[model samples]
Target: MPFIPHTEEEVQEMLVAIGAASIDELFDEIPENLKLTQLDAIPTALSEMEITQLMGKRSLQDGEPSCFIGAGAYDHHIPAAVWQLTTRGEFYTAYTPYQAEASQGTLQLLYEFQSMMVALTGMDASNASLYDGASALAEAVLMSVRANRKSKSKRVLMPRTVHPAYRRVVHNIVRNQQIELVEVAFDPKSGQTNLAVLEQYAGEDFAALVIPQPNFFGVLEDVDALTNWAHANGALAVGVVNPLALALLTPPGLWGEAGADICCGEGQPLGAPLASGGPYFGFLCCKIAQVRQMPGRIIGRTVDLDGKVGYSLTLQAREQHIRRSKATSNICTNQGLMVTAATIHMALLGSEGLERAAAASFQNTRHLVEVLTAIPGVEVMFEQPAFHERVVRLPAPAKGILRSLAAHNVLGGFDLSADYPELGNALLVCATEKRTEDEIAAYAQKLERVIQLQGGVTCGLVPKE
Candidate 1:
């Protein structure tokens, strides 16, 4: 891939050798209609320095926006060493381990990742990793249907409290299939999945019930009651969780009397930086019996002929591995690099460090809620116990307030109108451990100023009846 400079004389000589007058003549065999006569839309090429300066100036427009938005992706502090070590040539350039014996290092790392995920979720087994949280949830839905041998139903109950993006991805992926995805509404006051509506739909005809922990609105669902209800109705309970929250809250596997059948979530909060939305991994864990139906690769540890320990691909459900028509899943590879980053992050922040981080995030969010709610026209919308994010109703439209906050270099959470239209002028705000006290205060000050200038009035806190 080294650059080679060709001279005009060299080109002319080559053209002459090929019996062509010019480069255009070389492609004379091609039809004229197929050839592009011009590319006027593309800009003229610029010098290296000019291009660099232009890019730098454009990037400066982004400024230093204090992020409070956490609809799904978060802004968490990542240790520098996590990527420093992960980017090593050995780990960076490694590819799919088709030959399991030859990929001991990769297999071992993935095995460790799976082990950590299982321990974190309190599940019997974990897959290597998946495309992302949304797709992982979709895969979890498919697995639930497959695992529910007793049920002849293809219906799944998805909560409105789940991230709208995640739900959309699931619909797009599974819409062509015969499966029916039923939406369960949430309590407008509590912002949690309405247990009343849930009870009506929770029955034998449903394949699974997808529950989001510290759901899209950042309101914690009554997971115990929901899981128990799902079990009682002979439906699999699929918990869409936040991996970081598991540090302080109870794991899905330990929920209810019976426990969640499957657990999956976004792992961006682990150690991955929010590099403009992504490159984050998704994790899925399940009971031991459902391991066979799980998607993606699974690495396992065993002993060799000489009694030496070895690591290899334990199960590959993708079409590439097994019979194409009979394959359990079509996912060929796991998000190896992201998994590597997450494994290192988990190791760096052991159990105690993770607990501290989680506790700090919760406290920071509470602080944010207090300061923001003190504003004249701001109020907390939900009374439920939340982890590190909350929903707040604003007198003015959230979109307008967010734009005003951006003018002050602050990203004031996500607007809830589009997703939850009934929650008028609401915003989903988060304060991870990375948010400083000063940032919270500044956000409050900016928000109050914005609301005042807009002549907005408060409805105060709604009665939690």
Candidate 2:
């Protein structure tokens, strides 16, 4: 139970080999003040049977509430088959397919993942995967800097409405890279990136401009205008997009239609569970010209001497493992298991099914928004078009309202006031395809009651009785 397998003699022998008299001697370098004098509050060891019963009792107390939260991670429907397939010994236990010959299955799945990403983003090439969306954006920014060797742009512009974590990741990656991170402000009225501000910073010295599709506020930005502005200034446009939103909204490749050079984003909604925050995958796709600068691994199809179709690691020389510091990024592992799960999920859904799922989410969210805004004290934050998420101005403090919603067994939306002070009393609500009509209606009704009971109007735009 405790995994204390070493006998006393074995432990004494190990200590002798290390020139230590006892285990405590190994910690002699640590100061006494920093050492714990007593054990933690956890209970003493129990029999396995007793531990199981205790754990079962605690687990029963933790109930799963219907959730509405989706700032970055979402609660979309994951197919049962996805779990069954991903847990298979081949896909689940395998690590990096370092040797291409021994890992044909892993390599082929990576290849399929690349193909799906290419189709989804409308890009010429795609990498196997990265850590997550934020890291993917960081890698894309670095790649742009590398690709523009002659131009030597030292500035990168991102909109304020991009995910806060992503913005932080960019800052962290660029700190020692001698690059200036410029965050452009968004339009308060439209909740989209301010193109005029973008124009001011979009010069030859600017490396790339990152914009989120259906930005953090869930307002869809004018991709065509943003891309044109970035390109006209000789900078690349990097799109941080929602994979599900790509179903109804145009894919980032369409942004390429608008002149985008690189497209990257989180693929969590594709099938990956929001297990806490992750085990998520970051996708990077770009035009052929920028392929060499792309971080992470890429698998390609080839033929053997017998002329049979074969798969092998194609873009080896571009990564850190092969090229060291000169490589595009230090990332080595491709998030193989997560990528495989997403690939399998996408394969099952296909293009048409994905589009339909996206449409359902959009419709459900819009319906909920309309119902919530109808209440006396609630107000829609922006008139801009959105996908499955929307921001609403709350009559009462967002925290209080969220607490009340929680009491009613709902996981409420993210409170924007936590990050954007200007958006005081604003809550960012999200609805996925998993939300039933009854659940949406009930949430809206509960929100209305909570605000009204707190001496706040239900619809902010309406006159008090």
* Candidate closest to the true structure, highest TM-score: 1
Candidate that scores best on lDDT: 1
Regions of candidate 1 where Cα sits further than 4 Å from its true position: 1-55, 317-319, 458-465
Candidates in order have lDDT scores of 0.88, 0.85
**What tens-digit string does per-residue lDDT give for candidate 2 at 1-465?**
277899888999999999999999999999989999878797788988998999899876656777888898888888899989999998889878877778999988889999998888888899998999998998888888877654577788878999988889888987788887888998888888887777676444788888799798889999988887777777788888998888777777777445568989999999999877889999999988999889898889998789988798887898787899788888887677888999999999998988988898888889888888888777799889998899988887799889888988898899888788898789999888889989988898888788778878634446434
TM-score of each: 0.89, 0.88
lDDT tens string, model 1, 145-250? 9899878788999999999999999998877778889999999888899999887874548999999998998888999999998898888999999998898888
Between which residue pairs do clashes occur in model 1?
A: none
